[model samples]
Target chain A: MSIGLKKARAVIRATLSKGREMGLSPLSVVVLDPGGHVVAFEREDGAAPGRFAIAHGKAFGAVMLGMPGSAQMARAEGQAYFMGAMNGLFGGQVVPVPGGVLMRDGRGRLAGAVGVTGDTSENDAEAAVAGVEAAKLVAEA
Target chain B: MSIGLKKARAVIRATLSKGREMGLSPLSVVVLDPGGHVVAFEREDGAAPGRFAIAHGKAFGAVMLGMPGSAQMARAEGQAYFMGAMNGLFGGQVVPVPGGVLMRDGRGRLAGAVGVTGDTSENDAEAAVAGVEAAKLVAEA
Candidate 1:
């Protein structure tokens, strides 16, 4: 029921495909297991190294908190100090942004998460959802 | 020239392909740029999460030291304290093991490095060389 390697790679491929279809800039995509460990990751040709960290942070934060990126962003706005502390606790892997999407399996159990970077927050979120859905998993963005 | 996404992904694909052909264990591969930044990474299905960190550390250590993993291992044997200090300096990203291979361009300039994990050290090094060579880059192992 976790995010297996096949699904993780599929999510990365689909995310990049959707980004190309939408004409978004090169992107970095990261898939993390429920434990906030990287399952798979890729950075597009033009994507910078920092993009990977951001994408990973977003996904790690969402997965660790059991909340979607949007909710994390909202919470961050109201509790900036708490968010900062959490980031420190996790070695700065908490990015409260809209690009992180939690995944659910057939029975609504948590699978993992996908994070996208390289476009605006909203665009990144859109691509993340597209990728998770393409892999036959529900995206809670 | 730096490691581009095309070559990076090719390296990972070829590495996994070679591992499969050799009947090796599932592997995690990491490609790091000359500057010690990640360009691409993938952990095969069933591979433990720690494999990614180990692979990354190997490649990062090789690239940062401007030496192949074999050389690093040899040096570590003779200078364990120095190696330990280097590991601490780099946040434990220095894994002096044979699975890390430095990549070189046609002109003999450093392109990047590849790290492989999930098998015996010799088998991992073999796969790393196979992958870098398959991508038309030279492997310095």
Candidate 2:
């Protein structure tokens, strides 16, 4: 089953609201389908200019690589040349950050991913997980 | 005067609904903020593989160039070299096509842009304009 845009937007909204409640800096959130296509995206007011791009990249990476951003970073460890080549091939769409989290359906099928940017990477990942949970989906970080 | 995600999503939904009513093929729509950042995006099921990227590129071009995609295509006529250079400079983020349209607020300020893909260019542009109108915004094309 595919993740619909409504669900994606719900995830994004939940993530941004959680970020705000935590008194974090402004955030940008992006949700991508399993095919690495954007389902929903939002940049909160006062977010930095580059936040949206970074958020999108993280989410795209998670979906395209079939791994959470943190795990991707871990796998890319000590492989700077490989990472560089991957980035070059994908036009820098892969971000090795902690903000990307994979989503799965109740049947353990891949749904998509959510990415958040702004504040610390850990906090961003936390918010993304919170969003997936809020959407009643499983977040695989 | 930036277009918020809520409004952008509304526009996208309206466009998709209209496309459905018209019996058009599955579509992918994208909305970009004034700064050329994605505000919202959606791809209907069954949409062709590259539709999302094409929709995004068209919307980004509209917002960054301050004109509709059709106009951009017109201006690019007899300027293949310039258009090529621009695409190279922007990393292929710009698409000169008929489906991209500019959005303006009631106060005549630049708001954002909407782009549609997966149908005839004329139908795509029509759907985009209908979406902006449904949102009570101006569609400049």
Candidate 3:
């Protein structure tokens, strides 16, 4: 199932809320559809610069590879050259790191991916997961 | 969060002051809005050739990507091809290196960015920071 704009906005809000709750740094979050296009994004006040692109890179990489960001990170470790090539092919939009999480519907259909930045990678992942779960979707990170 | 012309000029003046105080080489400084459009700039006497373009690229990359130039440089190391493609996409304006700093207002909203050149990258960054501070803005280098 494709992600709608409403859901995308909800994901962003939830992600930001999670970051606030966790006391993480000001965050940037992006929600991308299965096609790797940005559905919605938000860069919080005081967040680091380039966060939107960074967040997009994480989610785009996850969606493009059809894997969770954690898995992508693992693959990047094992296939550094391939990942590098893919990153080039994708115009440097693929960030093989944590904080990119794939979303699935109750019936296990791919919806989209959520990417979070402006904090530690691990913390970003946590925020993404919370956001997806808050929207009643399963997060695969 | 945009910087006015007056503040932009102040940033330029302060940057030059820092350079003069430190006795660095002649310097060029470019201030760009969040959209990567040049707001104000100056080239000190005896500044190296093409310094304006160099400074512009630095500031443009930071403002366009919404990240400090130093962070861009770090990302460029592992994603060489990706960075190359990005550079080409932006008309070779993306300089993935230090000497570019993001400006933030009191509310932490991004105001603009400053790019300094004609000296060591580190020194250029310091001057940019000082310039932003002189304008009463926060610097993220």
Candidate 4:
């Protein structure tokens, strides 16, 4: 968990820095434990008020479902009902949209997850994946 | 973990049955693993929003500290930083509120924990304790 927090801090710092460099507004970053509980959170200046909850939920869903939230959204064809039902199943703790990515270990095992929000879904997902890669943590399934 | 969830649900059902006889609103119940991961949760209609999260954190703190949440709250009064520090350390995953209780096993050892919300803290605590008891589990220390 501690490693998740530390590595997540760097991830958030790097990703958010990139967003800023691209003239993107401030953002919120959330990290979840292996069991999908919040490990750390950072809300940048001027980030949307709802980003905290939304980002956390997306990140949570990422690890809970063992996939990228964006990829899940992209792949949904007939199983959309399953995605819709998850919010209720998780007690509203899950967001099926993309923008969150799972963290992995050297052996390509799931370690934790990270989420980024405050921009388009693609932007958020990219930021999260970038963060994971920057930390050298594998995001293998 | 399964046993903890089973006991937690049974405790909540019994407590709520009693509450109905006494004329109370619906309740929400939660159970946690020794490591603070949620084992299970149930929310009766009309329970307050996000009760499960609070209950989970409380139960987790009880297991980690080997005491009830209320007692922890009492101690926090003098220690002040204890509760907040734990919440921060756990990234807000350990709450010292009153709705959490501990679970024990046949050998009188802690097996896990339970938490209840959506009612008075006293009722929540009672329900949590009752759930563990209904599981035929004992609480020693």
For each candidate, report what fraction of the true interface contacts it reproduces: 0.58, 0.47, 0.21, 0.00
Candidate 4 residue lDDT tens string, B9-111: 4665665565566565666665555555544445554455465577667777787777788888887887879778877877677777677777666665566
Q: What local lDDT score does residue A12 receive in model 1, on the 0 to 100 scale?
A: 91
TM-score of chain A of each: 0.96, 0.95, 0.96, 0.88
Poorly placed runs, candidate 2 (over 4 Å) = A75-85, B75-85
DockQ of each: 0.71, 0.48, 0.25, 0.03
CAPRI level of candidate 3 = acceptable
lDDT of 3 at B110: 87
Evaluate chain B of model 4: give its TM-score: 0.83
Worst 10 residues of 1 chain A by lDDT: A43-52
Residue pairs with clashing backbones, model 2: none
Question: Between the candidate structures 3 and 4, which one is better when assessed by DockQ?
Answer: 3
What is the TM-score of each predicted model, taking all chains together? 0.97, 0.87, 0.77, 0.51
| lDDT per residue (tens digit) for residues A1-141 in model 3 | 989999888888999999999999999999988888888999998664566777888898899889877887777778767777777677777777789899999999999999998887899999999999989889999
- In model 4, pairs of residues that clash are A69-A98, A70-A98, B11-B131
Cα lDDT of model 3 by residue, B1-141, tens digit: 788899999999999999999999999999998877889999999987799999999998888677788888887787554455346445578888889999999988889999999889999999999999999999999
lDDT of 1 by residue, A72-138 (tens): 8898899989889989988988899899999999899999999999999999999999999999999
User: What tens digits encode model 2's per-residue C-alpha lDDT throughout A9-83?
Assistant: 789889988998898998888888888777667777677768767998888888877889888778788776776
> lDDT ranking from best to worst?
1, 3, 2, 4
**Residue B59 lDDT in candidate 3:** 93
lDDT of 4 by residue, A22-139 (tens): 6666677776667776544556645544666787888888877887786768655558877778767776867777777888778766777888788887777777777778888865
RMSD, one per candidate, in order: 1.0, 2.6, 3.8, 16.8
